[model samples]
Target: MATPGGVEVIGTDPAEAQTVKLLSNLLWFGQVVAVTEAMLLGRATGIEPTRLQELLAARSGSSRLLERDYGTVLRGDYMGAFGIDRVVEQLATVREMAAELSVPFELSSLVARVHEDALATYGPVAGEMLAAKLLEERSGGALALERLHEE
Candidate 1:
């Protein structure tokens, strides 16, 4: 398929590939938001065990969904299915926003550390790409999550 800027890439349809990449980026951003929110909530309200469990369950469910989608895209052999650099850039943006908004340092630090580890292990680009892919799969359809909870 023809990539933008005349860059040729192999594997899945270019549109599909781009969609996967976009989804992955969204997922990563969501994860950062969710984690930061949860941390702030815990600090402010003192999360009960049951609430924590619910949160954990939700996080796990989301992660699983993203993993499934990422795997599918990878198995489809999409070359540009992931974009790590974009992820890092987005993360930096998130950090800046949090600082400007006066978000707690602890939460921001945690996010930074997590991203740092991810970058170290997966390399900046690959790590973000993989993370985004996994997150996208986990998010899935909203109905799917509701049904999962019912089951």
Candidate 2:
């Protein structure tokens, strides 16, 4: 990741480096929307979300995001590592970047909408995974551990 100048330089171009960071955040936001939706879908279909989450984690669908965060989700604790409002903002930037490049951005747009909904529902300060809470609420069940329900 070192630039041509020296090992201390992260990138040769500042704009390109910023774009890389933005795209990485955008991908993470997309993954959150997707993983949460899958959990909700499994719950709606009579499968325990925890079990389904385990299956996804163990199989080809596994992602670093899912592996690291899904357990926190099951515990009813959406990590406050990032805010829903920040997620929405990042997605919007990605959408604008895509439009400028004349690239098809349907998936990015959808992901943005999901984060927007979460932001609207939970406000700016809520954690990134509040989107999962929104989906769970819409499904009339939660993706929480049984002990979380007891508490």
Candidate 3:
């Protein structure tokens, strides 16, 4: 079957396939944190949040998730397509999997905590960008995007 982004076979076994799926989700979750932090930093340094978002999207630092979620983030829609609670659950699953493999996952553990904190603050409402919202809130409204006027 064809999809927007060509799909690659991960593994033959269902367990392995599921592992890959969880890993992919974990990567996206991490990217959300990174991109949001970068945007917040840009704001702190006096760059407009929207302009910084554009630069990041165009620059080498861009990721598929960042590009895909751009509009949603700008509009503050956040998890309009998914639940923050689900994100926390997935991160927890990935962390558990890593633990079972005896792998050291300090960074992943931190990423999981970011989402856990978001889930705690937002109560599992829709908006994958809740972590971003959390950061913006922490920054005292520094990362809030100016309203984009439609032409």
Better of 2 and 3 by TM-score: 3
Ranking by TM-score: 3, 2, 1
lDDT string for model 2 (103-127, tens) is 9999889888888998888889859
Question: Which predicted model would earn the best lDDT?
Answer: 2
Indicate whether candidate 2 or candidate 3 has the larger lDDT: 2
Please tell me which model should have the higher lDDT, number 1 or number 3.
3
Q: List the residue pairs that clash in candidate 1.
A: 65-137, 65-138, 66-134, 66-137, 66-138, 84-125
TM-score of structure candidate 2: 0.86
Tens-digit per-residue lDDT, 1-151, candidate 1: 3457785564566666554554455455455445434433543465542344346656744564343433333232222544556566666665665579887556545555555554555564544434333333344411122332553
TM-score of every model versus the real structure? 0.35, 0.86, 0.86
lDDT of model 1, residue 35: 42
| Per-residue lDDT over 27-133 for candidate 3, one digit per residue giving the tens place of the 0 to 100 score | 88898888888887887898877788878889898888667675566666676678999999999898888899999999989988988999999897888778877
Please give the RMSD to the true structure for each candidate, in Å.
12.8, 3.6, 3.5
List residue ranges in candidate 3 displaced over 4 A: 1-8, 146-151
